[model samples]
Target: MLPQFFPPFADAVSLPESPASSSLGKALELLDLFSLTSPLVRIDDVIARFGFPRSTAYRYLKELCDAGLLAPASGGAYSLGPRVIEFERLLELTDPLYRAGQQVLQEIGDPGAVYLLHNLYRDKVLCIYKQGPDVIEYEGRRITVRRARGLPFPLFQGAGSLALLPWLSPHRIRQTYLRNAAEIASSGLGDDWEAFRRVLAAIRRKGYSTSQGTITPFLGGIAVPVLLPEDRKLVGSLAWTVAAGAMTEERVESCAEHLTRAAQAIAREYVKVAADM
Candidate 1:
């Protein structure tokens, strides 16, 4: 479940309705409904959420299932299908950041730690890849590293997301701050724009950001921004997550150092590849 401090993924923005009229558009909309928190959705739920006529909703669902974009599950529900897996594999193969991240993860050589690669897309922070230990026990329940690839988060919330903020132009930062003021305050990052700017300035000075239980309780995160030297553009961020109980000051400092080093390595490789292309 998403913590109350975090907003629902669907509510990130209000999508324009111009595309809703087309069959292809509606099909894509159906796909958008599947998210980490609500993976399995029922036909009735679709009807209720979208207010589509029963017949029309079923037709769209049928089309998606037929095309392997969605698949039937037990109890008359549906989940994303095999084709989605194919697309994800293709993305990993094609995305340079993912390739660089794989190398960085291998170099880090910590199989017990969780690492994530994130990039900015359409003004949102998108998790591109996740690696490390598959599961960990938390509060007596086994928590698997949830599949986060392609999951989007607000750009100003978590440490990984905020790592990119320092590189944004002051105008863009101000705009984002005003737009998400309530959420920013609710997140405990800041209660006002000045406070928020100070937080980002601190990250800029230290070259990394750290937080405890900001995104998810009992999970501590540290992140460093990936910036290419030639253009001085922010590429993305490298982040590590660990159980809060294990987050000593020494551990946090070590994680920050590792992430900063990995970020530098990824930036160099990424810049070289982009130049060659």
Candidate 2:
């Protein structure tokens, strides 16, 4: 479960013991139902599918809506809201590094899917870009960004998240990773610490990371960390996605190289911005 402290609503529901009272799970499931495929959903649909009490369903939806996590559609249906969009914008524009990275992303391909930078805020990775469709083919599949803006994801689920690992101090990394490790491991991720350590170490050495079949079953992700040239601390990462069928070691490597160069260029720009400051 995503920790509530990261987002106040994450922990609002109460779960029961016997047969798993399932209130919390149901609430989360309800939110998952409103993804790109079903962006606009009705409360009645949630009620009908989950068999949640009308009062209970409304209560959770109201809370989400109030928090700006959800918005009312025509006919009282629900969709994602502007709050997430605003937050994502703030995350990008507030950081000179990310703004620079966005520019690099725009220039990298022949109108391909672009990228945005993200940080692990409140335990979830938050997106800050408005990307369009771009494609790279491998193994009979395509790689591209699924959508733009306000896409919240688990930090343990992709190349971008791994990129953030090397920039943290060993102490901070141990603490933060340990705290979230159990939750991450239990959340259907591989339970191998050794493997995670290797992945992070490889990212550190290579200056980029790639993962397939992690966040989305048939999608691949490639990412590189933005580092302070002087201190080399990880600020965030620039990333894009690929379809599972398009995943190939060679394609992943190509993406990694390009993303690293872009990240370095952005880092250079950020350094100049800081120097001016």
Candidate 3:
């Protein structure tokens, strides 16, 4: 079960995440057209998806390629470009959550575990920092700390995602429940509002969360949320995962103890970082 805090993922909910309102937003949404299966977006794909006129499609493509947010690929397609990597590098050098959580993880490094930090970002839980093998092969399937680094993920599953839920504000929680009831139900967090609250309440009362391969196969994780004491808001989560083959109940309790303490230190550092801003 998850906690009942008002939804605590990233920026405040600005509803209706579709039909990019500005030229810039529309152009950026074009980037969303590219994915693993469609790694190279062609002009027709953008026009078909966004319904942009032919001339506007070409212009947008040219502008994106020129700006290095996209690069022309073989067969008249475009792929995300070097600027994306540069931006990722820049964020790592400066994002406060990543900075604080990663330093703390270094202090508690374990060869057999994967340390992770996740936070809300525009209605999704994003793994902001990960210290582990890039991919773990389990049951002939390849999985990583996330589907892909830098990709946004739905908040309905995973230890990192579930752990942060209890610290959200009540209104946010209700709003999230309303908007994502189906997903919430499917996730087994609850099938109804009261049930959802009760489930999350149980997680909250426990002071941490655990998942048995809910988000990944053959791995179990224990997670603790990071709350800025002065702000009284849950901002993110810290978690560590261990392969089920090697996991034991004792390890879960010990990891919870270690993560709880690390989360506190990271929260304190977070306050310092916020102050400097």
Choose the strongest candidate by TM-score.
3
lDDT of 1 by residue, 206-240 (tens): 88887776677667788999888677787788888
Which parts of model 2 have CA positions greater than 4 angstroms off? 1-94, 134-144, 186-196
Residue by residue across 1-277, what tens digits does model 3's lDDT show? 3432533444555545455788888888898787768888988998899899999999988888889999988888889999999998988877788888878777766665677888896558888887777666666766665533465667878788889887787766867786898999999998887788888888888888988777777777789999887876788988877666546778888888988998999988887776786
- TM-score, predicted candidate 1 vs. hidden true structure: 0.71
Error at 97, model 1, angstroms: 0.7
Instruction: Give the clashing residue pairs of candidate 2, or none.
Output: 113-134, 143-242, 218-244
TM-scores, all candidates, are: 0.71, 0.60, 0.81
Q: Could you give the C-alpha RMSD of every candidate to the true structure, in order shown?
A: 7.1, 8.7, 4.7
- Please give the lDDT score at residue 22 for candidate 3: 84
Best first by TM-score, ranked: 3, 1, 2
Off by over 4 Å in 3: 1-19, 133-152, 245-250, 274-277
Q: Each prediction's Cα lDDT score? A: 0.78, 0.68, 0.79
**Candidate 3: worst-modelled 10 consecutive residues by lDDT:** 1-10
Which structure is stronger by TM-score: 1 or 3?
3
What's the best-to-worst order under lDDT?
3, 1, 2
Query: What tens-digit string does per-residue lDDT give for candidate 2 at 1-277?
Result: 3222122222343322333256655565677687667889887888888787889999888887887878998988888888988876675556676566667666665465546577666456766554556455657665555534557887676777767766666555545555577865664443654444554565677777777777656677788888878887677788867676666788888878877887888888877766765
TM-score of 2: 0.60
